[model samples]
Target: MKPRFYDLSMPLSEKTAPFPLDTPFSRVETMRMEDGDACNVTVITMSVHVGTHVDAPYHYDEQGLRIDEVALERYIGKANVFTVYPREVDGIPIITADDVRELSISAERVLLHTETYPEYAAFHANFASIEPDAIDVLAERGVRLIGVDVPSVDKATSKTLPAHKRCREREILILENLRLEHVPDGDYELIALPLRIAGGDASPVRAVLRMYAETKDMT
Candidate 1:
């Protein structure tokens, strides 16, 4: 059976929103063919965490592995996709441990589709975030990697980053700012690899998902 593929990466450009105080995505035409240059060359500048990106263990754990040191196998494998709309808890939209426990995950990688922060043009401060307990629940369920549609697993205003710390302690990978609104919940093969940036904390990825289905006879 052939499989259907879904792109889970955001389009990076000047319009892509950056994290609060982080560098925005930008591109400059260094050599435009229209300007009589030999070829069209463009230069881009942005934070590694700007678009759909994977965080290395070093992102939170000072003694953890860097982006180049992580095994590529972790970024490519079977993954479970689930959707969760956070509920208001103490005036904040949060995915709790109870919420994570409700998901019937059968894969090492789990992607959550929360409709919050649905666009790349602007930054939203109140996007749904995951709690530390939720991270713990995912870890206990044998989830090695976790993906979220929102920009972060922790609150936008959080300084301590409890959720991120918890994931670090659990040795779970994190993929943030994924484009998951169009993707449905199911088990799929996920391929989201980060660049081998030496000593980098995070790197944007061209994330994709493949779902198996019955083949149709064109007779």
Candidate 2:
């Protein structure tokens, strides 16, 4: 039987919601067949974090690796999906350490399905965020990479970014803005390699997941 797959990345376009104060996606046609050009050509402008993207340690640490410098192996591997329905406080939901420890995740990379930021058309300040201790719990369980359905692991209004700092300290990679609402909880092989942008803090990635049966024999 043919294998099943799921695309976890959000679609990138002019309407995609970007982190506040970051660049929004825009395109300008530089040349087109109708304009007598040989072929269609356009220029795009947007933040690296505009869509589903991976963050290198450079995103928060001054001496950390850049997007191009981070190993590709970190993005492609067995990944477990853990879902924790939100329980909000002050209009924001937080995933605590206990929330992650209670799950029987057995992968080095894991994606959190919080059902926050359900749509890509708008940015909401009340989306779910993870606590720093939760990062520690994931690290204790041998997680090397973390993915979230929300825009950032920290709250939208966060300035200190404790969660990001903890990830930086733990040397864990981060993939954010994933579209995982329709994906069920389970183990799968992830293939979400980021762009090799030199000196970049982050890069947009096309996150994909293959069924466990398709990758069980793979190394």
Candidate 3:
């Protein structure tokens, strides 16, 4: 059967909330059609990690691949959405190795949908994050892509940045600040395309998911 599709990416804008350390998102007017120009055009500039985005291996590894080096298939495929939120309200929860194991996700791509959704559109300093051990589990499971609904895989104030390192070492792609309130845990086709930024550590993404059913073995 044809599956239903849902966009799981956060909207980008100068007004959107951003990380404390990074500069606030900014888009100044370079050209305005209101000035009697031929067309209405505006120059845009912002941090690569500003809105819904992906983290390349280069984000943490010195010899990792850059945003432009990422392949199309890496961000688009059948993925499993796992919800490990342990809070009553949608908040960042610590994901452990056991949690990864319980999800039974052996696919190349995995999307983590935290409980923060449906009405959560603002950024929070503390949100769900994966433990370093959880990163190991994903690497061991041969997961090539990992996504979440927060700004960074590491805590907002992480000292070691272990989560980013582990994923980078394993060549796992990281998609962050996703809008997964409209989605649930299940098997789905994920189409998350990142900007082709040359030698960039990360880039914004336009992510979408298509729902599907698993058929019995034909072999």
Candidate 4:
């Protein structure tokens, strides 16, 4: 039997919590089946960066690529899930180059699994973040995508986000707000798909992974 795929996204709802200070996600009914409507439908109005989402280069760079401008291959490929338990990675103090060097990263998609699960399920303060140095390392290494388990890559209080800038400048895709507790650090086939919103800076993504089984034929 083939292994099952695990979903790594938070449920979106009217009661669903978003990052601190961000507007709460809302779903309003544009057409309802209960009101003798032909179909049940609703229009969603919320920040693209609200939940599990991907940030295009245009998120930070004015001249960078938008959500629709990105290629399909950027979101799907072999990815590495690296787990990190940083007590505090807010502000300038965050995932460093040395921390990244320790991980055996060879995949184009580097998904960082910070053990900040459950704790970040609801509204909370201070999610684990990535430092500029780590971003520098990723950019230099030709990493195509950088994903994390938290909302933003930098601290919530950051005014100038060098980490976002580094990746944006290099055209590296950004995937955030993933549930990485169930996934371990290893090689896997990553499938992260984002909405093709025209000129959108970001879009929520449904991220998952497919674990490969060892084949006896390899020997």
Best by lDDT: 2
By summed lDDT, which 10 consecutive residues of candidate 4 come out lowest? 210-219
Off by over 4 Å in 4: 1-3, 87-93, 213-219
Candidate 4 pairs with clashing backbones: none
lDDT (C-alpha, whole model) for all candidates: 0.89, 0.91, 0.77, 0.77
Candidate 1 lands at a TM-score of 0.94
lDDT tens digits, residue span 1-219, model 3? 344688887666776776776655766776678887777666667778877888888878778888898888888778888877533225446777877877788578988877643333356766777887888888888898898877778877787898998786777888988887767788887888887888999888788887645332312
Candidates sorted by TM-score, best first: 2, 1, 4, 3
Give per-residue CA lDDT, model 1, range 45-159, as digits (tens).
9999999999888888889899999999999888999988789977779998999899998989999998988777899888888989999989989999999998999999999
Q: With candidate 4 superimposed using the best TM-score fit, by how many Å does residue 28's alpha carbon deviate from the native?
A: 2.2
Candidate 4 Cα RMSD after full superposition onto the native fold (Å): 3.3
CA deviation > 4 Å runs, candidate 3: 1-3, 86-92, 116-122, 213-219
State each candidate's clash count: 0, 0, 3, 0
RMSD of each: 3.5, 1.3, 3.7, 3.3
Model 4, span 39-135: residue lDDT tens: 9898887788877889888888888888988998888878888887564532333577778867777788899987654554476545667777777
Question: Which of candidates 2 and 3 reaches a greater TM-score?
Answer: 2
TM-score of each: 0.94, 0.97, 0.87, 0.88
Clashes of 3: 3
Instruction: Give candidate 1's total backbone clashes.
Output: 0
Q: Which stretches of candidate 1 lie over 4 Å from their true place?
A: 1-3, 212-219
